[model samples]
Target: MADPLDLFLAAPPGLEPWLAEELRELGYAPQTTAGGVTVSGTWSDVWRLNLECRGATRVLARIAEFRAFHLAQLDKRARKVAWGDVLRADRPVKIEATCRKSKIYHAGAASERIARAIQEELGAPVSDDAALTLKVRIDDNNVQVSVDTSGEALYKRGHKEWVGKAPLRETMAALLLRAAGFNGKMPVVDPMCGSGTFVLEAAGMAGGWQPGRDRAFAFEHLANFDAGAVSDLRRLDGGTSLHFRGSDRDAGAIRGATANAERADLTQATQFDMAPVSDFAPPEGPPGLVMCNPPYGARIGNRKPLFALYGALGETLKTRFAGWRVGIVTSDGGLAKATGLSLTESAPIAHGSLRVKLYTAQL
Candidate 1:
């Protein structure tokens, strides 16, 4: 049996607490820290996280750490690492380095040294286009080396091929749903569903579907990979009743969303239609959560007409969606206020270059 590893679940800024909560629900003891949550487990846990955890942007294994004050010392210690035990000789790898408050201030030089060490010691070719990456961070003379087990970002979800402009990432959507207190038992409605990210996520949760069942990870190329063990992790628990729905004014968006649902095999659990917010109506069942990511003029164009759009959305929810809860993601505070829904703001989350917040309210 191999020794346990330090597993770090990377989250977006200001969403670390929610991600930590999600890890706890997954039956792991998680320690929340800046930018991420940390836990300890073996290779099986790594595979399980990549396959099941929805809120994590990346799952990294902190394989090695040491102190190095100079380049020669760094190179010597790097060469001493048992790279063959963790990395493969046939697969190409990339090295990314960052230096902070350390004597080794040159990040490029540090990356080059590590790259040379891997090539000489493990015989693995280094390339910028490699899917596997080794991250080196030097903080106050302490060097922490981790491997990005998740090659592409986890938000890709392996099934969502089509997307609209200013689309929300799957990771962020899951975490926001967590913050909104959504489990799989209740229905979820997205009024402005672009490609139906929230609806698809809700259906997957209710249907007991693994997020990475259709995806591939970089860990498959590592020396510790076990195909049979990983395959066993995909056993589904047989999902609950379906009650997810979505709507959009654009005909093309509805078509794309329906296609995405079909690709995920979640069509039985979800419904998408072409309707503007003013025409939005609640599902016939018990009241659930209403979530949407509306245009905030920063990513999409014009801000003026958005005020009227928000006003109509607020009116529809207030009058039609009685006994329901609401959550909206927008960058502009004024736009959120235009809804007039008595919303409470969450901590600002980093969305690309722009920071956005999730506004919640009970209608």
Candidate 2:
């Protein structure tokens, strides 16, 4: 058996606890930290996390660590580490460095030393646009090396193409759905759905599908990659009976969401319609989760008219969507309060450049 390794899962700034909870539920002991969660496991666990995790934005495999006081010592220590075990000779690599409160605080010198070490020791060429990325951090003179096993990101689930204005990321949408007490047993409705991210993710979870099934990861370029073992980890989930639904005022957004759902093979489970929030109505079934990522003033148009829009949404849900739960994501708390629903604000989450919160309530 391979020796255990320290793996770090990076989440959005304020979403570490949620990511930690998600990892713990996946049968891993997660240690929550300032920016991310650290879990220990073998190589297969690293691959599995990259393949299965929906809440994580990126997975970094901690390879080695040592204390170095100066640039020469940092180079000496970096040369002793095993680089060939993680990197391939044919595939190029990119190195990023960070430093804080350390004697060897120069990020450029640290990065160059490590890059030279990799070239001389492992014969792997270094390039800016490489497939693999190695991150070096020298905090308090402690040199730590990590390889980014996730290439692009977990949110680029390799299916979405037509994105509406300021589309909600897949990772945040999944985390929001989880926070709203959704377990995929009941139905899901997004009235102001931009590109149907929440609806599609709900369907994927219900069908036991892997989010990274369609994407290529940086782990495939590692030395220990096993084709047969990875094949076992790939799961193409079957169709689900529980229908997930979404609607948008923009007909183009509705068409794009439908195309994306079709590409993800979730057309049967997810349906998108071109309708405004005033015409929103519950599907013919038991009450379920009513969630939407509505427009905030940050990216879209003016916020003056949004009060009426929010009031209309709240009134529609209040009169028609009885006994159903609601979650609205917006950066402005006042607009969320304008809904007039008794909602509990989830902890602020890092969305693009602003911090956004999810306002949820049971009606």
Candidate 3:
């Protein structure tokens, strides 16, 4: 049998449980951490994770891990790894190293040593624009080396070509939908809907679209990966269609959302409108989900006016969206409280440098 896959999925801080649950739904047992999750699978499974997983920032395949006391031992172990089996000599590769509380504390030297070994011993061409990236981390006297399987961050999705200021990432949007218990059978509305990220993600989920279908991953450059299998998997049918709706007061945001939805082939699945939150109307459904990433005061121009915006949002939700589930992503807890809804649960999630929280409520 093929060697078991040692996969590590890095997430924004405080999102480990969300990533873990997502992986479990994909038929893997993931061990959660403060920064990420660790799991085991095959090469095909790794492809699936890169293509299907929406909550992960990057998917890494652990190649080697050992205890190293000094630079000589680190170099010897790094050189002995079966790089030929995993990496193609025809493709250029780059190594990034990090050291913490280790005898060999110089990360740059370690990276240079590994690069030299790959170039001199394995005859591999090293390039700055290498498609494949190897990451080395020395923590607690243990050296861990991993290969990045996803070329670009999974959040890119290749569909959203336009974005508003402080737009939410596609992966974080998808996770927020999942956290809100959105199964795509009901309508979803985003009142603030900047660049329509949340709404588009909902539409994709409702339409049974795979996030990575149109993207390229780093594993395609590996020597042992089967290109045919990857192509076949992408061709697999995703069977589901559900209603999705989005409205924003900004006309520019609406136009961007329209174009982005078209790029994702989701125009048929999503409906976008130019309307302010006060004029927003809930879609025709029993009890669906309403998710929004409103402008936080830090990025936007004013803070005092935003409080009124949040209050208006709360009023609208209470008056219009009875029985609907609500999820709001925000960095300001006080502003979140302006909604005046009884929060069912709230969990912290990292948004770049800011630690934002997803506040959810059921009307």
Candidate 4:
């Protein structure tokens, strides 16, 4: 039988279809559900998904799934499974448990039970920042246990060392690029490219680069996984040369982005400049994507100036970027409306604890 793999993708409310399509593009025809998608593949395909997928927050491998009515039964089943095949005795692991309408409704108690079982029976260490994590969800007396294969949330990318205040995450940036219909063929302009996350992610995608190429994943510690096979699969090179551009009024932000690009070995693929929004322009193309996460007054502490900034942004897009697509990530709806551009679609997304909306405009 093929090595069964279950993938979990966390999306904004009403973005499961987008995630499913992203998976399909990666050669996994995922079955869509209320909050996530499920797919079956081998270990090779699992590595590919972890490397290539930009829309997913985490990818998990379902190791065991069964029904349990009590904590004793859960512990018995968890211990009965061949833990040696999946977890190394020396490597540390954390257990996160959630109970919903189940007999064992105490999440903490259940997590403790599992942790004790893994440690006492299997000799694995317990930790919170473990490279590997076990996720257990008990719903209606049915238990599903899975191991997180993607370590460090896949957005770390191991490239960005400096981040500005309220910086957009790499995963969110990639999804916004896709939502804006950006194929990475044209020059992408970020007027307020704080830390240059969008620009770098676009450059990587344009070059067909894998996100996990330089990072280590939790699944590598699993006994069933073959290190040589994973290395061989990742040996395929993503060819070179990409066109991406980012600009910010802050000279420091530009410098940070340049340094980050150099660290990611993508300096040749992206260019960073220090320029104000009023001076921003599309680079000789009608098909480029203009994406920005401007100051929203909550973290930046200046609402009045932000309105002017949004207005200036709207004026720029309306005057210079005809036929180009625009995407704005902002938490303030009023400030976004100040842009005065016709919005085509707006979707709610969570960025940390504060919920934000992604607005799309066509010019």
Stretches of candidate 4 off by over 4 Å are 12-14, 235-242
1 versus 3: better TM-score goes to:
1
* Model 3: ten consecutive residues of lowest lDDT: 235-244
C-alpha-based local distance difference test score of model 3 = 0.84
lDDT of each: 0.91, 0.89, 0.84, 0.81
* TM-score, per-candidate, Cα-based: 0.98, 0.98, 0.96, 0.93
lDDT of 3 by residue, 1-363 (tens): 246978899887776787888889889999987789999998888888888888898899987788888888887877887778887778899888999998989999888878887877677887768989999999978988888999889999988998999988888887778877787687788988878898888877777688998788889888888988888778423544566778888899899999998888888778889988988888665778999989887667677888999999999999999999999888888889988988765666778878888889988
Across 1-363, the per-residue lDDT of candidate 2 in tens digits comes to: 136888999888777887888898899999999778999998888889988998888899889899999999998989898888878888899999999999987898889999999999999999999988999988998988999999898899999998998988998888888888887788999999888999999998778789998999998888888878988988877667899999999999999999999889899899999888999899998999998888889877699999999999999999999999998989999999899899899888889898999899999
Residue 37 accuracy (lDDT) in model 3: 94
Model 1 spans with C-alpha error above 4 angstroms: 236-238
> How many steric overlaps are in each model, in order?
0, 0, 0, 1
Q: Flag regions of model 2 displaced more than 4 Å.
A: none
Give the clashing residue pairs of candidate 2, or none.
none
Error of 1 at 301 (Å): 2.4
- Better model by TM-score, 2 or 3? 2
Candidate 1 lDDT for residue 61: 95
Would you give me the overall lDDT of model 2? 0.89
